[model samples]
Target chain A: MSDAKLLRDELRKKYLEFGLEAMSDEEVVRLVLSLSCNEFDSFTEKLIEGFGSLKSIEDADPQALVRYSDIGERSAVLFRMVSEISRCLAVKNVKKGVYLRTTADAKSFFAPLFTDHREERLAVVCLSSRLKAVAPASVIAEGAAASVRASCRRITALALDLKADGVIIAHSHPSGKAVPSSGDCASTELLASALSRFGIALIDHIIVAADDCVSLRETDIPLSFRDRECFGYKITKLL
Target chain B: MGKGSIHSGHRDRMRSRFLTLGSGGFSEHEILELLLFYSIPRANTNETAHALIERFGSLENVLAAAPEELMTIKGIKSESAFVIRLMHDLCKRYSATSDVSADLSDDEKLEGFLTEYFSENHGNVCLLLDMTPRGELRSTKCLPTSSLLSGELGSREIAELVVRNGFVRVVIGQCIDGDKCIPDASCYSLTRLFAETLAPLGTELHDHIICCSGKCFSMRKNGSFSFGSGGNHE
Candidate 1:
């Protein structure tokens, strides 16, 4: 057998013996790839070279994987499956509990939304009467490289369908600071207003970036529940 | 200030009441005030709550308002605002999963539900299930660590376990391998003994399943064990 096949067999044995955490991300990718496939080693190296990290690789599209590399269609499909499985496993921890009671709970529940990323992704989690997660739906996934703009209308529609009592809107900033930009503040207000019309509370907006999370509600900023009137902050430029 | 002291006094009373009565005791403003304490630490949140309610026209509106509007109020910072938001999100998450009860008559659904507790490292589990008359799962417990992966557990130990739990209609699931759904011939030998033990107690062993990877095999479904009686044990 070729080197990749030999390595894959070894990793499989270790995975069965130890656990999923036994192998690193690239090791996982290397093991999943084919020994018989043509022009894959240099392709992996080049893909990593271009993306700079394993998370970026996982976040990229299979179309991008195929377009950027010299690998076959089947290999790209397999790579996508691996990436999807990794995400599923990451989110599985939060699925055990139906309710979230604290910002820490919200942070833990939404961690999967932030992990393995190269660009921003915005999502809204809808909650029922007891503060339990009803559905966590994606609001905007196909944003620009550095930012994502979530639509208030779409989030309101989803919360209405779930008959949600509350909503948590969140986003990831890839490898940057977790602080909300001025635009983030502006958009959140719009979304919050929209959600309020349906009597669903816009609970909090969380930004996850670089292993840290910033809760806009928990920050020392002027934005808080006690003051809900728009104080003439010239945010039109930012929005 | 006198106003600060009054607000602090009210916040303390609200918090104490909340501990005793749970969230059922608080109004929307009271709930928002309580949640804000986590983020704001030592602030008098009375005026804070009032300001928000006035601007947003209700407790939900205040909690849901944009951070910019929240910022316009004094003492309402990011930290305090986050807690309000958190309370809202927590409500949403709790509602999503609490609506469904875990009872079902379908075998496939039971199997799917049971699979949640199994993973590669944890496949050593053996579940003792108390089943309803309609084959719905009433309760399930893993036979303790002493009888875990060693496979030293016989039907006698399982019989005692079922007796202790007072379970009548039973189903057993043992994972032989982490990823393989196949059962050994030993499953039949053990299940036969289980049926034999339960027959005298007026209870029944309905099924014995071998769970592995993501699939399972049921002895009752395959007709591997005879449902006949044996009741000579003390």
Candidate 2:
């Protein structure tokens, strides 16, 4: 018998013996795509049960499916392809121009920020005239009580770059304790000063810790330096 | 043929068949498969192994997932989650307690453990262990710092613990905070101390790891705290 014929016969036998339960995730995909909508629905349900859920089947790695007794390479690849499509479809729905106005909004905004990190990160959230999010919300600097000097510069540059009317500097305490350090205070002061030079307001410096937040603007830390303008040698003016 | 020879021949055949069936082996996947062996008695776990990798995106991601999160999978029960978490525990054991159990020097064991154990904690934590090389009772504390532990851990009081406890090695590990590649200050200081304090004792101060959320980064591996573009270690 020809190779193709032999393969078909073997697959047929396995289908008869194992039912759909034994069919590979790939075969299931092929059958579903080829079938009419009603048939596809039935097959999909069967698949959901066998594989446990849509997420499991959707998230299943193709190579793993091939390890099944009757599954082959083609089946696994097709299964993975379907899941990829689902992911693309899911992400495609989110549009830009969305503004974060609340804690939930901030959480959603920062969700992607912490998705794949391995270190605690600090970012400065700059806001435009409409309080919309401007680009570059982070200033990269490190060390325990490490100076946030670089962060100040980065935040100022972001504010200037985005031409924002005001800015909120934010940093994450990956340790989950959202308390602001003295370094945070110093950095916020520096950033506020730099932003004011461009007529940008430093509205808040928020520290995000594991599960809480600390707003420095709410505290008694010095914010008046932001009002002082040192233009040159003898021109020290408090705006 | 002697009776011993006959028994040996039978054992060899069984071994070959076991190898062919790929039922028992020491491959990384096999180790992962075995992790679920206790929970899944009847089914082959190769597919589950691949499923976990696909679902989570990588092996490290799987290990990094919370046991609660892992139990959300369809086929996974509480027992399975426990088993999976145990693999991480086992790896941690290899790094922190293995040397002592093997009767190696405390300092040597600590160094070896740091290299091996800390690699698995892809998230940042400040671990305060109170145990001797011989598995003696000591104080144990775990402070999850996400990806920063340097400042909280950099105090002289902590340093004093290193000297007093005679810690042969110390690990300052972190979980990558996010796309914020700004290195964590606490992690940096903690690692610096980890290197300095453990070194003089002839104990190897292994790399302080910044676990990028799902995987780990060895400061020693990256050469410095400098993070890559879009890597979020900043």
Candidate 3:
């Protein structure tokens, strides 16, 4: 066999033996590109150099990927398809009936929902009394890159319709930190109080930003409604 | 109506509601009240439940509270406190026995099991899953830390554990605190090392699952890592 064929065989063998993670980014990219192009080593190097990383290449538009001399429409579309498939599978892997018992659970479930969205979006995960999710997350609102509004009435209606005992409100900060802004805090307080009146617990308000997420409940922001009495009994203040 | 009859009437109604609708139909305080009814008798458990929740901030915290701490509440005597503690213990026992024969080879099943296993666990910790040749989980052992880079638990120690227990198929799990479920370089290296070590001894390293923020990343399913010829035993 020729040198190129030998190298391809070696890469395939390593992948089967040690797995894709054992291979370098360049080797994995080259292996994928090799299926389409004969002369993929130099092309793979150029693509990596141009895109900076495999993740960036995956995130790149098909049109942008086709700008590379060696990459045709077929190759670019292949990259995009793989990325999209991975994302869909990730979202699907979030099984229903999973309990959102803690801030981390809420963050994990909501993080995947906000992936790849450049604009701000608000979603609510309705939970049963046992803290299990009643259904998948519903994107109730979408807005510009910076801000999105969450209507208390709409959220309450959805919760009532689903007969959810609790709700977790989440919104993405596409271009900003995961820290809740003043507006976010105020809106969360209002939403929490509004839901409380309906006897639906506000489990958490998560702010998802890229790969990071923060819970408003875990932060220093005090929620007054959280302290209010329930069942007609005065709450004994804890020291 | 008499005060005692009023209390008895309300208890009867609550009991009926509980039997018809189950615990999921009740609020946190209501559930606690129902549990307190058996121990506290005809007294108003609604007020006691409210007081318990208010003082502890949540029903979970109340149950987790010590018997001495529970007695601080007005109506929570020794019997009621024991009932609360009993509920907590019963939950723990139920979780432990329910999924003992779980098939770890199924990605979804493994993920669900790991999510629950690491729910109460905080910070980063390593877990070793010993499984039968048929992929049924045998037992799980939790390590001190998941930082393989720190040399806290070496591959040799894990290999020994597998050999000593005669576990033919094993899986490794780790719980990280952040939202990123993807394995880092050290994790990759550790998984590779573990697989290589176990492969020689006829032990299969099924998958290395990284549990983070309730999400599970399985190396075998993601095609990120492979071990033992990638054959399906199940």
Cα deviation at A53, candidate 3, in Å, is: 18
Q: Decide which is better by lDDT, 1 or 3.
A: 3
Name the better of 1 and 2 by lDDT: 1
DockQ (C-alpha based) per candidate is 0.01, 0.02, 0.01
The lDDT for every candidate, in the order shown, is: 0.56, 0.46, 0.66
- Which residues of candidate 1, in runs, are more than 4 Å off? A1-80, A83-97, A137-139, A145-150, A224-239, B1-234
Highest TM-score, which number?
Answer: 3
How do the residues B1-234 of candidate 2 rate in per-residue lDDT, one tens digit apiece? 976666446434533332222211223344345445446655656677767766886444666678788877666777677545533432332233322212222334434444343444322334444332222222222343421242433445444545543443334434344755335776676666555555555444444555443444566556774322111122
| Candidate 1: clashing residue pairs, number | 29
Model 3 alpha-carbon drift over 4 Å, by segment: A1-75, A145-149, A210-212, A228-239, B1-234
Summarize candidate 1's per-residue lDDT along A1-239 as a digit string, tens digits: 88755755675566446543565545545544523254455566655554433434443344344545556544554443333333332333245336666677676566555443345677678877577787544434433623323467677777888788877778887647888888888777777777677787777787876436777777667654314432221111100
TM-score of 1: 0.34
Give per-residue lDDT, candidate 2, residue B133: 24
In terms of lDDT, model 1 sits at 0.56
